[model samples]
Each structure stands twice: as structure tokens, then as C-alpha cells.
Target: MALYKHSAYVKTSTSDEFDKVYSPGASTPHSGIYRCEGCANEIAANQGNPLPPQNHHQHTSAQGSIRWRMIVYAQ
Candidate 1:
């Protein structure tokens, strides 16, 4: 099974632009948006921890891991 994760910064966005862009599915939580440091994209609202897909390569550091995931916007 594929582990799916949402962005955190998107959940923190004060503006509704993220919500307008992503238009997360009904199953998606209606939270704030998290800013993705990796892609410079706005995380969708109400999603989980907006991390990259498990199969993708993520950025790792000695201290811990950075949330470097791709932003999926509603088209």
C-alpha cells in the first residue's frame, strides 16, 4: 500500500488561496496549509503532514528529516 501524507504549512496559511488551489477531497481535513520548503509550493489545507510519497526521495539531515514533498494542486 502507498502511504499518503499532506502538507502542514498549508494548514497554517491565513489565506484561503491554498484551499482554492488544492480543493482537497471530501476525505481531506479542512485545516490550514503548510509551506513546503522543498518545492516552494503551497500545501493544501486539511491534509495530513504534507510529506512526500514513500516511493519518492526525501531530504534527510543528521538532526532529523525535513518535510520535502511535492505539492499537488487541484486542476
Candidate 2:
């Protein structure tokens, strides 16, 4: 999970983009901390840049495929 020292810098949003998921190597829709759905690994990505490639990490059979979900939005 993403951590912060000051709550004043963070605010909640109602944007639908927060609920969307992106595939590996896909163009990032927003800049923020993205968590891997399968492994819970987090990565900082920038908007318009491609996410980590397929071989970025390895997972077990139980972990499933590499899928990314935005957990924190860096406005």
C-alpha cells in the first residue's frame, strides 16, 4: 500500500479512472502508485509512459497474471 506522512497533501477523488485497471506495457492513463493485482507489488509510474513489461516480475501459478491497479492518484 502507498504511505504518506501528511494527510493534507492527499485528497479523495470521485473520478472513474481510479477504478480502472491497465495491462502490462500499456500506456499509463495517470501518474501514481500502481499495485500488482496478482502479487501486491507496487510501482511508481508516470502518465503517458508504458507500464512495466511482462517480464518485469515473476509470479507463481496461484498468483495469476500480472495486472496493475492504481491505488493512489498523484495529482
Candidate 3:
């Protein structure tokens, strides 16, 4: 999870972007912390930038694909 000490520097939103999942190497829709659906690993990505490639990490057959979902929004 994304952590911060000062609440004044962060706030919450109800954007539908948070519900979307992305593929590896795809352009990010927003800048935020993204969690991998397969292994639960997290990465920070910026909008318009490509997400990590499939080779960025390894996963077992049971872990599935390296899908990404935004969990924290950064504006």
C-alpha cells in the first residue's frame, strides 16, 4: 500500500479509473500505485508512460498474468 505521513499532502477520489485493469507495456491512464493482479506486487507509474513489461517479474502458472490495477491516485 502507498504510505504518507502528512494527510494534508494526500486526498481521496471516486474516479472509475481505479476499477480498470491494464496489460503490461500499456500506457497508464493515471499516475498512481498499481498492483499486480497475479502476484499482488505494486509499482508506481505515470500517466502516458508504458507500464512494466511482462519480463519485469516472474509468475507461476497459478499466479496468472501480470495485470495491473491502480490502487492509489496521484494528482
lDDT computed for candidate 3:
0.92
lDDT of each: 0.36, 0.91, 0.92
Give the clashing residue pairs of candidate 2, or none. Answer: none
lDDT of 3 by residue, 1-75 (tens): 667899998778888988899999999999989999999899999999999999999999999889999999888
> Which lDDT tens digits does candidate 2 get at residues 2-74?
7899999999888888798889999988899999999999999999999998789999999988899898988
Return the candidate ranking by lDDT, descending. 3, 2, 1
Better of 1 and 3 by TM-score: 3
| Model 2 misplaced regions, further than 4 Å | none
Whole-model lDDT, model 2? 0.91
RMSD of each: 11.9, 0.9, 1.2
Selected candidate, larger TM-score, 2 vs 3: 2
Cα error of candidate 2 at position 37, Å: 0.4
Candidate 2 lands at a TM-score of 0.93
Error of 3 at 36 (Å): 0.7
